[model samples]
Target: MSKYTSFPEPGDDHNPFQDPAVTQHSSNTEYATLDLYNPFDNKNGPPPPAYAATAPSAPQPVVPATTPPSRTTPTEPRNYGTSFTPQTAVNATTAELLRKQEELEKKARELERRERELDSHALGPGATRQNNWPPLPTFCPVGPCFYQDINMEISQSFQHTVSIMYYYWMFTACTLAFNLISCLSLFCVEPSGGVGLGLAILWVLLFTPCSFVCWYRPVYKAFRSDSSFNFFAFFFIFFVQVIFYVIMTIGIPGWGFSGWIVSLAALKTSVPVGVIMMLNAILFTAQAAMGVVLLKRVHSLYRQTGASFVKAQAEFATGVMSNQAVRQAAANATASAAQGAFTGAAR
Candidate 1:
């Protein structure tokens, strides 16, 4: 043996540490035990491949299945009529609104019809009003100057009053005629009393038309149109007329009135003539009494109609301002005044 070479120990070939069979047998037993005891193994599949023992199997990506949410149904049933919902409430409200809108349209149509009727009651567009007052004959040269129908023009509530007023007007005319005859008779008795006959004629001519125009027409228009200004005019002028009637009823001798004094004076001359004059005085007194009664009645009606002085003033102002002829006249007057002032200044 050389000095650098190592010597083999006794029984080296038979040692278990160096034996290949023993090492291989121990490794096989360990592998079989691990295969049987592993909690993560799959027994139903084929055994792992031989190379799988050396390296781990690649982990598979898990793709979970998607599921929709469950919808639950109502357990209890409901009645259709009694059951309430947001949709049903909204529908009910819409129907109510439509019904109210229809009612409003009906009311508006009714109002329009009423307005047309009111317009037609007056002289509406293209409607001609014929002159019927005085009831003159067709053969006569003089024709009716005014149009009047109490039933058609005046309201039912005021028709009775207006008729009475008309009768009073006729009575006044008859009284004037009687007074004229009485005055002529007195003039025949005393020639100097011809002045009384002429005055009586003038009064008959003047007072008849004047009374109709100043007071009677105003009352008619006031009742027809409920005009406050016309009411005021009727009251003022009718009061003056009533005062004149009372004065005439007193029967002044020379004033052409067939009053008590004049009638008594005629009794001294002739009994039949005095009787006629007394009859005329009685008529005059009756006329005065009727006039006073009519005035009271008319004033009561005016009070009921709620007329006032302030309303009359306002109505008068509005009527004057709105009248086309009045406005034209006022404009002309203003222009004339301005021209005159300018001319004077130049001079």
Candidate 2:
């Protein structure tokens, strides 16, 4: 033992269990301890014979997490009306079907409402300017008619019409007065207040036809074009009339002038010319006021429709009230539908 001498090498032929004294340190050595009877110890079958132990087993991993969304599952049902649809991740087809059904119901209710409204005092198609609001004609995705018709043709024609009308009114009044005077002077009792007669002839010959040419043709153009066809035509005719009015002012400077070229000879027939002048002036004045009022009405319509002034003014000037009614009706219809759906669901 002092020299660390070894005993005879353990015999290969001798079993350690049968020859115990030489293997006495085995109880204190490191080794695995598994219980053969434990289910988990099977390891798909059973632990190897050498690795078996007698201790109890550990817990399993098959169970899910302790904290999950399902932890607070509601004991009571959560109810919402059909309108308040809550789609689940699971059946997309069912969700789509539900959405389609709601849309169909909405459409049906709207149709029924339209029928009821029609049975009442509604005037035009969807009168009061709600559903009947015509979409602006366009050349794009929304509409088929080209806006060019309104922009290039109708608008221009409208302007031209206004201008032509202005000139036409001025010309008609002036021409009517001059022509009537000429005809009346023909019957004047003073056989030759002849200067009056001559003046009347000159008016029929020069003033009437010239004014007609100056005013009426342009008016035709205006109706066809509607837009500002020729502002100068307006200015030219207007300026000429202003000059005529000034020269013809109450003093009657032209009345003293030679011949019908410069006389109130048309006044020879008091009744007809007087009536003509009165009607002509009246018609012209009314036109001015009528155009202005209509323009204002059209502009208001444009603002409500989100249309630009440059586009056109074809819509009616009734929006604030009409739109509000549409909104209120839609809301009431939707609410009623929802209430009915929920009531049915509850039942």
Candidate 3:
């Protein structure tokens, strides 16, 4: 075989095995057909040579020339909704966390303020509380003993109710004073009535402070602190006081109250004294009526506060157990009993 072999041209009818005469006769016509068949003559120059036709670099993908995309999106044709950027998502989450932190800080500050109020009321060390009641002069020998300020200590909702009670207490004191004057008038009319006058004086001295301490202070504390035990205490003591008011309004002679009966009897002795006694009776009756109204109002408030006897009992028990004096007394009693039993056993 030759190193350089020419391929057989197209359209030759004779092979090498055939006669050379037939091959030579077909060669000219084949050559002429091939020479005239210019595949790219008028279109392109010529077809590429065989050597020039390679496997072709894997057809390079048509890449349209692209400029860097515009920072602003095109605003025509199709509507694209706001696209979410990572920075926007990050900022939204950060803002939410900051809002929550601010809320928590506000809550913490409110809690701290409430704690300070409680501490002040408790009269703890460094407390801002001071005695303001009995509002005596600075130069007075006796200083104020109680810290009492409805506007400062009581809640806004309760201030009106508490103020009424305070005024009622003052009214009660005034009634006692008038009762004393009425009894004095009766004593002037009848020397035998001196006993009633003395008793009336004693009543004035005793009851004025007792009513305040027993009932008024308790209810005040109950409303201020929402203490169930204090509410129960006020109810009990005030009910008893109301009963006493009723008894006094009846004007029992010798018992010291110049009530209706005494007033009517005094009418036989002196018109002026009877009139004064009747006025005292009216005051006592008013006191009893007011007491009843107050009791009803206080009970309604207690119910609204959701305080029950069960809660009161629990509070009382806890208070007793927590009291330093009560605990010390209990400890001493136990020690004393144990000592006594040990001595007896040794004997």
Per-residue lDDT over 161-196 for candidate 3, one digit per residue giving the tens place of the 0 to 100 score: 999999999999999999999999989879998889
Top lDDT prediction, candidate number: 3
Winner on TM-score between 1 and 2 is: 1
Q: Count clashing residue pairs per candidate.
A: 1, 21, 1
lDDT pick, better of 2 and 3: 3
- Which model, 1 or 2, shows the larger lDDT? 1
Question: How much lDDT does candidate 2 score?
Answer: 0.46
Instruction: After the best TM-score superposition of candidate 1, give how far the Cα of residue 226 lies from its true spot, in angstroms.
Output: 0.5
- Per-residue alpha-carbon lDDT of candidate 1 for residues 1-347, written as tens digits (9 for 90 to 100): 43455545554454546668667865774344453444375653544344347546779998988788675866665666787778889999999999999999978866665665577666666896788878989999999887787766777689899999988998998899999998888878878888888989998999998888888889999999888899999988988998888878888777888889989989998777788888999998999899889999999999999888999999999999999999999999999999999999999
Winner on lDDT (1 vs 3): 3
> For candidate 2, lDDT tens digit of each residue in 184-211?
5443533544654455466546655565
Off by over 4 Å in 1: 1-123, 336-347
